[model samples]
Target: MASKPPDILLQGIDALRRVSRHMFRYRASIIAFFAVLLLIYGLYLRPPSDFPAGKTLSIPRGATLAEAARLLEEGHVVRSAHAIKIATYLFGGGTNIDAGDYRFPSPINALRIAYAITVGNFGRSFIRVTVPEGATVREIGALFALGTFTAFDYDAFLAAAKAREGFLFPDTYLFASAVTSDEVITTMQKNFLQKIGQLEPLIQSSGHSLADIVIMASLLEKEARSNETRRTIAGILWRRLEIDMPLQVDAVFGYIRGADTYSPSLEDLKIKSPYNTYLYPGLPPGPIGNPGLAAIEAAATPIASPYLYYLTDTHGIMHYSLTYEEHLKNKRKYLP
Candidate 1:
């Protein structure tokens, strides 16, 4: 009747119709399987829909895993408190989670979220912290506290720092927000040792001991405002000190006043701190600032020059002089 459809066309249509019927017969089972997958997804693999996500949550420094899990439940991040507790147990018992502030959406499940925080895989957003060239251990400790890392005790960290003096290399550090104070100090110490180890031969070649190199590097760090200036200043300092002249530095005065930068007061100059380079004939008892690689290298291999005097100019640039006359001229030109 339908123009007696072509024979081949008829056969194909009949086959397609049978397949469609069979598919419809299995549709309910397919839907049921999908439903189970959805449930599993919400519980273990992915987050539930229509839930507020990416809420800010901070885990205190000494907070336990149970506490973190409870906070998640309280924040409505996880629907079931009991389930989260059970999950924490199965996910390495919550002991593995690190201490830090975390941001997560409802788009992830408990296991995945816990793993993210513990293993530090949430995102790169690694915290960026810079320790300037000459920061002391106490100053370095304070920076950790400022970053919201609580496990660091200032007094304890100071003890550690003293034991590892001249070894806590100062440089920029990138770590997870949950990074501990001990970890940071340890890392710096290791770096310092490794770095100094590499420079040992150079130190020996300079006809100096390790302590001598450390002292020179410390002075170099205090004097350097730039890479080029560091080399220039190191030479002047070496030249003066070699001739029994005072290695006068203002950082010593700053140390006595518990300040890092300032114009010196008469009282500050008179303070009898061991770090008084102006008063003392040689390098201070220890370094005044944490030195970088460049300053350390400059201390080892200074620019050979005949200059004996150096001072900072009006533009903060350092000018060197070979004689008293030149030094006085530089001072008159630069000092207000």
Candidate 2:
């Protein structure tokens, strides 16, 4: 084998030697070409010198990746739009960029920016807001308005949430500084569905429609504080509905007047509104406010009671009566 190398092998060795000599002759050019390529790559990865640190860049909802990159470049948050697009495509794993306000407290490279948008890293602090159990849509809007960081549109939220009064689940939510009215509405509605979904079987067997239950629960939420009292009130209210008697709940007046008073004036009670439970025979057109799980459960599983009337005294104690005269006596004793 070693006695004589094949002619082909000798030819290959000669070709390699020629190629090596050629490369050695032009090594400087090859090195310079690679060095230029690396320099360009490094520049692409670097943040712009005029980067808008401490500025917020808004990426509109439903915007494509290209649009987001353009916004970043235009806002001086990135060196180049093309570089960011390429970086996101290469590293984002085909995920859609999140839409919201992104604030940059400091300069960051293209790859970091791309990752931030792709993963929804808003780079802003979260505000913890608790929507109370009995809060109305307008009240919820006011609560969000108190947060200095939230850009929540109060009027927009009110308009959008008007029909979804009871469906907006009340809970503690940690919202980003840039949350929109639609986002808040969607989040609360989704949470309502999820929570209510768990009680679907109970609701189905209760012989009451979901709408009626929600409406009744809203009334119970304002009428009573304890779960036991809520269930008792629910029973009384349902009995009234069965007998074609007006609900006569005082809470709806507050909703009508956009006030927070449980006591309605005689003039206010005379107002002709569909929400007047004192005038209407059945449930009002819609829920007056949001209700918690306890109220909902009480409404869904009302306890059987023969009492036809009930009153909450000034001491917050509930009194139940079996006749109109007894109810009058309780009112006289409790009202003052």
Candidate 3:
């Protein structure tokens, strides 16, 4: 039998119908908003396949931003150029995106690419510049540039180096393209201070001034290519200095002639320059080369020995001689 519907049920039905009508009126707006969101998401989504999923990419020297973008897109790291720019912008503009080689896994997205460019690539583009033991400040600068820094007032560098001689640690250093010569110099000096600060007692106990240690270190540096050789060489140099004999280091002659290359000539030795130790009776006006830590240490605590002459053989091995006759024999055997 048909009975009258309850008032509450009828009211509920009416309310639902009114809400449905309102939703129909705004259907276009809802669809448009969702479509915009989809477009944005699709633009930035990384491609599924070639998305640099398994390999790191290299950004070689002189790479452009556009070229970098092309690489990322090919790797599927980014779906579109627009997406990469947007992601990079969010990652923080050109200032944030440091140019370097980057690695990306497959399915890497725009955000991942941006993050890699910003930070992950930092360690990838470094060059190692090794400053060998016994290199002078003048010598070190020359290694970086030839006549490029003719105006580079070495006065400041020399002033700093004179006080901190034999302290600049010899080691491998990593540097980015953005690094400057001044930065390198400061870094070496700082390393020197940290390293040599620990050897104050040794420098004092040797009854030698810091300059003396550096001078001895430079002399030792010229004579030794190994730790054992350095110790013995230090002894010989010390003995000659004590006896007031000519130090007669060929390196001093090379310095006088402004010669740093291999196999300096006989004529170079005869130059009447201030650095010629053969002509002058004492140490050179400056350190001959940058002295490494072992040479520096050997300079301070030399091995006690009675040998008067020592020479390196054809094999670059040293032969010690206690007398003139033995020295002549050594020269005849190895040098001849």
Candidate 4:
């Protein structure tokens, strides 16, 4: 007689068969679930790698992150297509990446690349340029060319900045290597507008035209070094204009000559240019150079004084005189 199978063994076999039947019935669903998991793993969790040497990718303007990812993968700059998009959407600050030409020289991670493009780290070199106060357009052009700040034509910059003199705020600026002259002007002009907007109330209430105030400020920039001196000279200059006296400021000669000299000879005064303050009364046609906020403020709000004439001596001390003879005496005594 064969030994009877244990009851426990039979129960276990029956349970196993039931489980197998259910699995067979849902085989397609099980396969689909695992396939989805594999797809997600490949697209997101995969590590990034460097493309073959010399490979480059071009992302067109207005392209979506998904499209950018596709192009990057096609160029072999990335290992996954949807990974970069997801990374940028999740981790990146969602800044609209600036549209421009980009260069990829070596391997960079997806997150890093995303951030770089998002913030416009174009993988090219950059330069920091500080346009000092009172820098003429010609001087600014030379700075850009000599410093290799960008591939800008000096003549072109001068032509563009000519109309924007005194409107371009002097400040330190960072620029990419491939910036154009027009782009530079736009940046500086925008900065000027933004900065001057802060003084809008004062500018409007000063009772002086914008052009006149700017002209006065330009003179103040070359006239004095300190805020106190700037205000004092501003008063004297405005008074001269009020009384129909020629400004007789030597700074105007520097503008005419395109030189930075502040001390003009008697012959310079004879130059027939309208910018010659000694020859023409009232403000010049336009600003001589970009002036700083302090000078602008001084020009807008000149301190009233009883004195009529002022001069900076050899020792840089300012001397004030109430009469023409006194002014002449001070000039001879201190200027010598």
Per-residue lDDT of candidate 3, residues 224-292 (tens digit):
678778888878877887888867777675455556644446776666776676666666666676677
The C-alpha stretches of model 3 lying farther than 4 A from their native spots are 1-125, 136-167, 256-261, 264-266, 323-326
Q: Cα miss at 295, model 2 (Å)?
A: 0.7
Ranking by lDDT: 2, 4, 1, 3
Model 2: ten consecutive residues of lowest lDDT = 144-153
Report the lDDT tens digits of candidate 1 across residue range 1-336.
456879999999999999999998799789999999888766644544534454456667777777777776676666665666666667665576676656663467766666665675553245777887777666787788774553456777777677555667987888665555577888897878887788777778877676767767767776666767787777777777788887877756655666767678777777677777667777777776577777777777778887888888777787788898999999999988
Per-residue error (Å), model 2, residue 214? 0.3
Q: Which residue pairs in model 2 clash with each other?
A: none
RMSD of each: 8.2, 8.0, 10.3, 6.9
- Tens-place lDDT per residue, model 4, 153-198, is 8889998889988888889999866667887899988998888887
Give me the candidate number with maximum lDDT.
2
Error of 3 at 265 (Å): 4.3
Q: What is the TM-score of each candidate against the true structure?
A: 0.62, 0.79, 0.58, 0.70
Sorted by TM-score (best first), the order is 2, 4, 1, 3
Model 4 TM-score is 0.70
lDDT of 4: 0.81
